[model samples]
Structures are given as structure tokens and as C-alpha cells.
Target: MTVIQWYPGHMAKAIRQVKENLKLVDIVLELVDARLPESSRNPQLEEILQNKLTIRVLTKADLADPKLNREWVDFYEAEGQPAIAINSNQGSLKAIENKIKSVMADKLLKRQEKGIINQRIKVMCIGIPNVGKSTLLNHLVKKNIAQTGNKPGVTKSQQWLKAGKTLQLLDTPGILWPKFEDPIVGKKLALTGAIKDTLYAKDDVALYALEYFVDNHPEKLKERYHLTDDEINDTTVNLLLNLTKKMGFKDDYDRASERLIFDIRKGKLGRYTLDFVPSSENDEA
Candidate 1:
């Protein structure tokens, strides 16, 4: 598979902008996709956000495997950090609000002690594009205050908005690093819409997706398209061929591949986690 990399001019600007404004916010909400938490995370986060309180917000929890979601949360918390999983759904939003409040409790207490009660908590939301930063912002405020789109680079600039009377949120453009040293990171990012579609080969991505399910969620393939054991265990190319035939695409493997990707993204196939969430034994070691 060919290596995939996409770093737009705006993303570079966003990196600088985030650093410039890092000290202004009380906390940094580092949003990432729940499926591939490590891959979706910006590796430069610690460098840009030095000495800043960062709360990892794993967005799109509804699209990810729930068991793995819990594991990933435990993994992050094991490092003495706060991690939260949320989606653009009911019940989860309230949980997100509570998490933000919980993290801000100490700062809020300080404000109260200084005779400044009801101070608005300032938060800077940063993450790779299309990981639901805008969605989270809108949910927190209960309105479409920021633009929302499926594609990346949607939020080109930063905008501040109020989430209730006590919280002020700064939504910044999704920033990706300059390069992806590991090709798998690019593939994972591309598979989850973190990377632009034009940069990667969809056939290869679809093949990887197929291999992932074959190894981890073979039953999902059976439930989605009813593939037999042979077809499930076939080579990536053959699997795509089988899918093409089953979907009546005949020789249109590209369309079939795109369809599979769409189904995976939209949860029509099944909930999946692209990365491994380590077990307790691995964590303790």
C-alpha cells in the first residue's frame, strides 16, 4: 500500500494559532476518534500544549465498539489522565458536560475564592479535522454555532462560543502534523476520514478494512453481506471481488470498496475499533 499524507496550508496556520492561544484557555479538549485513538491523536499535542491541562475527548463513541471504548478510557486514565467518550446523541452530551465541569472544578474553585463566582470556563477544542469538534461545540451550546461537514478542513479558522453561562469554548480548525512516519497511521486516518480521500488509495484502504474485520469481526462481515468462511478468509483482492459480485457490482470493485467504507463509517456494517485497546494485564506490565 502507498503511503498517504495530507497537510494543508491552513493546518500549519492552525498549529501556530493553537500555540499562540494555548495559554488563554483554562483547558484543552483534545478530540480524537474512538476507533483509533492513538492514530487519530495529534502527536504534537504535548509540544504545542505544554503546561496546559488537556482532556482527551474521544468523539463518535456510538460508532465505536463499546467494550473497546471502555478499555481505551481505562487505558488513558491509567496514565493519570482524564478521558471521555461521547457522540452527537442524547445522554452522552450531558456526560460530556459533566466531564468538562469535573475537570474545571479546581479552577472554578479558585475563581470563587477570589470573589469571582460564576466565571466562564475557557476551553480550546483542538483535534484532527472532522472528528466532531464542531458537533461537540454545537451540542454543548445546543445550537449550530460552528459549521459542520463530513469532509475535513471544514473549520478553517478559530471561533469562540458560549456553552451555557459558565463555559466559553474556542473551536479551532482541525490540525494534522506535517508528515506521517508510519504508513499505518495514514491508512487509519484515511479510513476514518481524518485524512483527505484523494491522498490515499481507496482500494488499499478497503482491503485493509476487510483484513481488519476478517481478523477481528468476521461475524460482522457475515451479518452485513453474508459472506461464507472461504470468502471471509480469502485474500484482500479476492474479498473485494467477492463483495463486488455479491453487491451486483460485477467488475466494479472500486464502487464496492467505496460502499464497504461508507457502510463502515455510517455503522451500517457494525461497530468497530480500528486500534487495539490493551487489556489490564498489558497495562499493569
Candidate 2:
């Protein structure tokens, strides 16, 4: 088991910033990867922002299994947390706006009863790096206000972006936990590009994904790579080699593995999720 770890100085500082800025926002827009919701969410978030109302967002819904997306939303809603799925790249953010309005209705109503006019809703968007926080921001603002890239740790600082008259957005760099208790969490994070590739072997990560597909999404794996039943049943390494050869990748397993991972990231292998069932059916904040 690879013990993947990455906690840069900036991330520590980001955590401190969350504490410092928690009170400034009326709600926390906690964005998490749709493909790996359980692993992408920082375990420390609920404890850290317990005093604030949070709306859990399942981001990159376009790249995850649609059924799992609904299931996750149901799970969070069952837990009493408001949840929604979005495809930021496709500008699917109207529901988030509606959700924000729904959650803040009572608060805004109270202000109106006190004769406060033109109430504004402030939200802080937080999540692990590369989970599309910036993309989501751009979707909501409909303008390129935040820097977005294909890798983790892109947003290195905090900035406030105004989204029209009544809603304000606080964009912060993604914060990940210091360490992963379960190695599988690390693998899932790596698979979803939450942790930087510099910290782990790309080939190994790709192999891990292939193994997961073999067990949980065999049809997808077979369909994408045209793997025979024998190949599917073979050892993972051997299956990878066979796939590499069939795809005319030459003798380069690493390149083939990279392509496999890239295809999965692009949803070429179909919409899949890496999260397992929650250990308990009980609701968690």
C-alpha cells in the first residue's frame, strides 16, 4: 500500500485562513469531486466550520456516474445537509444559486422583518485542490475571475468575487487533510487528481484505477479496452500489458498506463465513482 502524502506550507496556511474567514461568510460552499465524494471531502471540514451553515456541492458531475451522483446527493440530504451536483465546465450552476437562496431564505427573511433591504448572501467555496473550485467559481460568475488549471494547488491565495447584487463569493485555495488514515483514500485522491502526481507513481495510480474498474466496473473496462474475458480475469499487470499491446502502444507500459488514466479522467471508460458505501447509515454533519 502506497502511503501517499502531500501537505505543503501553503495548505497549512489555507487551513488557518478558513478559520480566520469562517465568520465572514454566511454559508460554506463545500465543493467536492463527484467521482470520489467521500475521499475528496476533507474530514476536518465539519469540525472546522461547524458554526457555519454549509451546502455540499458535488462538482464535475459530468465526469462521474449519474446514478452515483444522485445517490451521493441523496446520502448528504438524508444526513440533513443540502446537496447538489454540478458540471461547472458546462456552466451548470443555476441549481447552486437556487440552493443558496433556499438555504438562506429564513436568514434573509429575518433581515427583511428588521427593515434590512437588499440583503446579500456571502459564501466561501472550499475543497481539495483540483476538484474544480475555480471552475465552479467561473461558472457562477460567468466571468474568468479566478485562475483555473488542470492540476492541483492552482489557487494560491484568497480573493472575493462579487456575483451580482445579492450574492457574494469568497474563493479560497483548496485545503486537504494533513494525512490520509486509509491508504485507499490516498489512492482515490490520486486517481481524481486531488494530490499532485509528483507525489506518486503515475503508472501505479493508473494500475490501481484499472484494478478498481476490473472489480467494480468490469463491463466499462472491457468495453473501453476491448479486453477479452481471459484478459479481464488475468492478473492486473498482465491485463495492462495485453491492453497496451492491443492498443498498439508498443512495449511502453508506462505510456499505456498514462493513456489509460487519461481516458478514465476524460470519462472515455464511462462514468465511474471510486467511493464505497458509507460505513454507517447514520447521518453525519
Q: Give the number of the best model, judged by lDDT.
A: 2
Give the number of the best model, judged by TM-score. Answer: 1
Question: Candidate 1 lDDT, tens digit per residue, 2-78?
Answer: 75456778888889898899878989889989889889988898778877888898888889999989989998989
Superpose all Cα atoms of candidate 2 onto the true structure and report the RMSD in Å to 1 decimal.
Answer: 2.8
Clashing pairs in 2: none
**Cα lDDT tens digits for candidate 2, 173-271:** 989888889877887887777888777776787778989999999999888888888899999888888988987987888788778878887788888
* Residue pairs that clash (backbone atoms under 3 angstroms), model 1: none
| Candidate 1, superposed: residue stretches over 4 Å from native | 91-93, 279-285
Candidate 2 global lDDT: 0.86
The global Cα lDDT (0 to 1) of model 1 is: 0.85
